[model samples]
Target: MNIVYSSSDSYAPIAGVSIMSLLHNNTDADEINIYMIDNNISDENKKRFENMVDKFGRNIVFIPRPDLNKMSGVDIEVGRWNISTFFRLFLCTILPDNLDRCIYLDCDTVVRHSLREFWETDLEDKIVAAVDDCRSDRYKTELNLPCDSTYTNNGVLLIDLKSWREMNVEKDFLDFIIAHNGNITYVDQGVLNGVLAKKNLVKVIHTKYDAMTVFFDFNFKDLMKVRRPEHHLSEEEYIEAVTDPYIIHYTSCFLSGTRPWNENNNHPFVGDYLKYKSMSPWKDFPQYPDVRKKSKKMMTSVCNAMPKRMMIAGISLVHSKLYPMVRSLKGKRRG
Candidate 1:
């Protein structure tokens, strides 16, 4: 199996933990070829990654990050995400031609099961397969996609390089970016969904493959109420995903600066991340202070400590009553 990750020096330790987890969990697989889209990672970090992979009897290929300025016709403003995020876009251009398929995992993930099943999943003539984004319909509207279209999270992708090459996907992606330069909200993710979802080219995979933090943190009923209608995970599937997730995408927590490695984070999966970190080469890595302010942490703690029923009721009232009234008042103010 071919696994790809993109990271820079700043995120190398976190990326190392993710890679270690992948290697640790998928020992049953016959072979695992790891590839990293390098963003000038320091030699020390590279050695650390090498040691971690070597310990697992696996090897990694470091593909140099492509110059986006040279690759794209228009300048891409990579917001909160690093330039390495754009590296996935140019996999076909950067990787060797003989490599036909690869599984792309974001650095903010930890694998919890053998990926043989996921790695062997058939793309069914699609260029890529991914989990449906939690906010699928919102993304659809943001990108002006059809209501029935699937908006996928690019975090976990099973990519078919042959299809990408044959269909000139690279050119299409560049063209899309140039055409919709300033309109993109989620950087490369938005561009990917905008281009591919419109063509009906993305295969929607099981959520377990990219089980996000929101899957565990949010009430399932509340989640369903807010989710797009096109996200068609059955209750059974949803339960299976939450109960037996293969990959934990610490996406929301990571973005909110409440990642497990942060001192103030109390995310449920922080223990899981710490477990992997203890086993990794960076076992002694220190947790940094939380990026979230102390006041926010206190507020979050108070809210989290609320009784489940009360919490749900409060959220429901806010969504069903307060939010609509606030919108109405804003409209009246405009009038």
Candidate 2:
């Protein structure tokens, strides 16, 4: 199994925990070739990675950053996102031509199960297979996509490199980046969904594959009320995802600076993340003090105090009203 991750020096520790979790859970694989797309990783961090993988009897290969001359003039809205986020867009140029398939995981994820099934999932002519994003239809309209089109989260992509190359996905992605430029909100993620949404080329996988923070934070009814068709997960599936998730993506909490590695993050999966961290080389790394704003902390506390059913009801009502206003605004913009 080939698994890829991209991170810079600052995010290396978090990436190390994610890698540890993957290696620990997927030991059944005959071979696990881990690849890291480097954006100037520090020598010390590299050693840490080497030690972590060495303990598990797996080797990690670091792919140096590729030239981004083509994207020089393209405007990128890199709000809070590392420039390394764009590395996946150029995997075809960075990885060996002979490499035909690979799984890409974000540094903020932890795997709880063997990836043998996910690694061998049939792409069936699709360039990528990924779980749908929780942002729902809002993201489609935000990217000027058709309302019914699927918009996926790029955090956990099963890529078919052969198909990506044959279909010129790299060039198409570059073209989209150049065309949209400053209008992009989620950087490479926006470009990916915008360009791929209309192509019928993305396979929407089950939510258990990438159970995000939102999945645990929100109830099933709340998710259904806001998410699009492609993002739907049955009640049974939702329960299974929370109880026995294949991959737990600390996306929202990571983005919001409330991750398990930080003090007072309070995310439900903090223990899961810490369990892997304690087993990694960076186990003794100091946790950053929780510096969240008082207002945000208060809000989180209030939300946590509410009953799950009440919270879902409140979010559903908001979505019911907000979706119409969003549609109206979009219609006027089109006009």
Candidate 3:
């Protein structure tokens, strides 16, 4: 499977760690290549990442983009123009050409199961596969879009690169940003939804494929059964669930005050995060301190400024606590 990710210096270590988790746990893939692009990375950090991939038995394609430092844009929440504008260049041009189709994952996710299901499933000629954000229904109506599964999270994409290029998607998407002068919520994601909606070029993949921490309100266990139907797991079913996820998107990094990696956060996946961290080669890298600091700052800013729904927060907290108990009970039942 071809995997793609874009991160700046602040995220390469974690992205490298995430890639390692994918390689170690996902056995179904014949080969996995991580396409990582970072312009701001220190040579030391870059070398550390390379060494980590080397030790972990995965192929790494590292692209260094020195020219990206000049771009700038407002982060809106921080009241300062941050440097995420460079991602536009990545979305438009810098990607590699070896793969006709690719799975684009944010650096924050850890794959618990083979992504073969996502990569192998036909897109039915659609350019991408994504899930609608739970909160974006209101935004969709405001934008005059039909209230279907239209507001998608771009964090996990099953991209049909050929279709993306054939449809001139990148150019048209960039033009939309240019026309709007880069003022939009959620950056590239919002513009992507604006451009792709009703175009018959996007397919709504199973939400289980990208089970975001932000939207845990729905009956996901049921949804999982329905989509990958006939595969039902009772509350006592422990191994079955862990062994079969398509992707475990740790989108909590996108939320403020809510990450397992943070010192004072109650993230559901804290144990799992630590598990991956313990196996990471960054344990020996000298830049660990710097990486942790930047990761904390990024997650803090995102969570603090994001709009909160009390119900969602409550459910998330409950799920975090309940899941382990449920898993324990499932194990007993299975035994």
Candidate 4:
């Protein structure tokens, strides 16, 4: 199985924890080859990745990072995300030509089960398959996607390299970036949804594969209330996804403003993360503190204290309506 990851120097250790989890859980797979897009990873971190993977009898390759500025000549707004986030857009150009497909995982993900079934999924004519994002249709409208489009999270992707190269989808991604003047709030996620979500080229897979934090923290009804998604996983599927997740995606919580690695976080999957972290080279790494400001933490408390419906209405108004408007206006001004 070929898997891809991208990380900056500071995040390399976190990515290593995820990689170690994957290597441990999928010992049954015949071959597991990793390719990481490096953004100046320290030699020590590189050696850690090498030694850890070697311990599991897996092969890994490191690819040099590219200049986003040089490629686009447009100022890209990466928000709080590392610039390495855009590396996925250039996978067809960066990965080996002979490789037709590979699984792309975000550094925040911890693999808990064998990925052989997910890896063998038939893409048919689709260029990519991923779990749908738990959000409102308003986000699709924000992205200028069709109402019928199912917007999937880009965190865990089964990418078809042959199809991407053949269709020159990178051009589509670049055009979206250039057109938006790189002022996307959601960064590469915006590009993926804007470019591919409407074309019926992105298949929405089972949510279990990329079970994010929201599913665990909120039930199906509250999720609908908060996210106001036009469509989403059913209650049965949602329950199963979170309770028996195959891969735990430690995305930040709206209420906590933190992930499992943070000392103050209350992530349900923290135990799972700790299990793999203990076996990683960075086992001695310190747990991160909750870095959200006092004001932000206060707001989080306020939001949690408010009636669920009120919190839902307010966040939807800001997230789906106001926040996207700001992104669009910023893009237009930049353009």
Candidate 5:
């Protein structure tokens, strides 16, 4: 089976972690062809990836290209690189016509189960298949059409290359985006929703495949209300329910700064994230505990160096006065 993943230097850890899990868990496919498209990755990271390839003894297709530096100047308002332009670029330049189908997984996701089932599932002549983002109804509406529209997350997409190319789907998406001038919020994903909605080419898959964790208040109890056994857990319960999840998408939560490696950050799937991270070839790159300690020391030093650090510009005063309250707020936020 062919799988496509895009990697940039900044998010190398996520890509490394994702690749490691796929190689470790997936045994159903005869050949796992990893089409790694690297953009602005460091030489060290590339060497690390090469070491993984050597260890696996499996075929990996490396497609090297110039950096996306040109697009860097373009304002990325909605999704990554704006939805319209990114897809057009990928389909027109990055992908090949020889391969008729492939599974595209976002770097921030972890695949726990074998993807053979997903890869083999019939698309029914559709260009793509994905799961709905159940976190926010408003985001889905802006992306999918009507407010209650079931907007599938583009993080995990099953693409039929033949259909996509034949229908000029990418061009059509770009045309729409050009017409709208990239005003949409969610970029390529938003356009994918709009395009597929118009053609009725998207099939919604099971929720278990792309289980997403949104904000702390993502209504896990509502999940229990669904009669479907697959979707039966409450949000809080779901966080701890590690029954070999197919995919765990750490999407927007990582945006504001709490990473899996941060000691202060308590992720619901920290254990799982660490488990997958450990499997990666680059796992040894950063020692999380050491890094966290170093970061804390630096922050403390910088704060202490300030002239009024402990005086009136008072974070120290706040700490003294509201330390317990701050701790309480943090504790409440933990999943």
Candidate 6:
């Protein structure tokens, strides 16, 4: 199994917890090789990863961060998301040429099951396979994609590196980013979908492969009530994903915007994260302050004050109607 992740110094420990969970859960696999794209990670953290992977009898290779400045329009500011999020865009360029395929997992995810089947499955000539997430008709329209095209979460990707290199996807990614005038809402996410999904180059997969936090917090009915997605998984599949999720992606909650690693977060998977933390090389590591300031505290209190159902309804109304109307304005919707 080949796995890739990107992280900076501030997020390296959190990424370590996710890696520990992956190694701990996939012991049955014959071999697992991890490739971490370095982003100013401290030497201490690097050693932690090396020692951890050694103890697990796995391989860990640290790839030096590539220069994004070399790419046109890469200097554009991306909201909240860091430059590391764009690292995967150069995978075919930066990784070993011999590697034909790899699974790219975001640093925020925890693996709960083996990925043998998912890794070995064929892509059927597609460049990548990922779970369909963040569905919205406006997303396609914003990118000028065809009506039937699908949008997927770039968080967990099974990439055909060989095909990507053949098609020069790295160049295509740069062109898309530049064409958008260097302004992308979700940074690398918008670029991936804009270039790949528009051409029908992505294979949509089950949510079990990347079960986001939204799944844990809401059932299909309530999710529709809150998110108002244009497309989504069926009720049966949603339940299965939540009940036996293979990869738990601890995305921020809409109600409170909290994550499992935060102190006051109400994420149901906090226990899972804690268990993996205890098992990692950072087991003795102390928790850092969650770094909330007074303004954020006040907002959290305000959001918490609302009734759950009322908040869901309000969010539903905004997502299904008001938000779409707002996005319809030129330059408002992200590609």
- Which lDDT tens digits does candidate 1 get at residues 1-335? 98999999888989988998899899998888999989999989999999889888898988888988666756777766786777888799888899999999999899999999988888886789999876635446656688788888889999998888988888888877776652355678877898888899999999999988767776577566544344567777778888888998987531233777778666666788999999997889899766666776775666568786675566555544464456445434533
- Candidate 6 lDDT at 112 equals 89
lDDT of each: 0.79, 0.79, 0.59, 0.87, 0.61, 0.83
lDDT tens digits, residue span 33-77, model 2: 889999999999999999889988998999898756445465555
- Reference-based lDDT, residue 191, model 5: 70
- What global local distance difference test value does model 2 have? 0.79
Which parts of model 1 are misplaced by more than 4 Å?
228-230, 253-257, 293-335
In model 3, state the lDDT of residue 278.
71
Q: Model 3, range 180-199, lDDT digits (tens) per residue?
A: 45554455666677778656
Task: List model 5 lDDT by residue over 1-335, tens digit each.
Answer: 88887777767777878887787778666888887776667888887776775577656665665333343333334533422225333553566768888888877777788989999989886778887654333343334355434467788888888888888776676665654554544566767887775567888787666766543313354232211122233454455433446877766432123556555545566677788778776666664443434555665556546564232235423432344345335434531
Q: For model 2, what is the alpha-carbon lDDT of residue 66?
A: 72
Weakest 10 consecutive residues of candidate 6 by summed lDDT: 326-335
Q: Pick the candidate with the highest TM-score.
A: 4
Instruction: Tell me which of candidates 5 and 6 scores higher on TM-score.
Output: 6
With a 3 Å backbone cut-off (N, CA, C), the pairs that clash in candidate 2 are none
lDDT of 4 by residue, 137-160 (tens): 767776778788878888999999
Candidate 3 residue pairs that clash: 236-330, 255-303, 256-303, 256-304
Residue 328 of candidate 3: its Cα lDDT?
Answer: 38
lDDT of 4: 0.87
lDDT of 2 at 86: 81
For model 1, what is the error of residue 270's alpha carbon versus the real structure, in angstroms, after optimal superposition?
Answer: 2.1
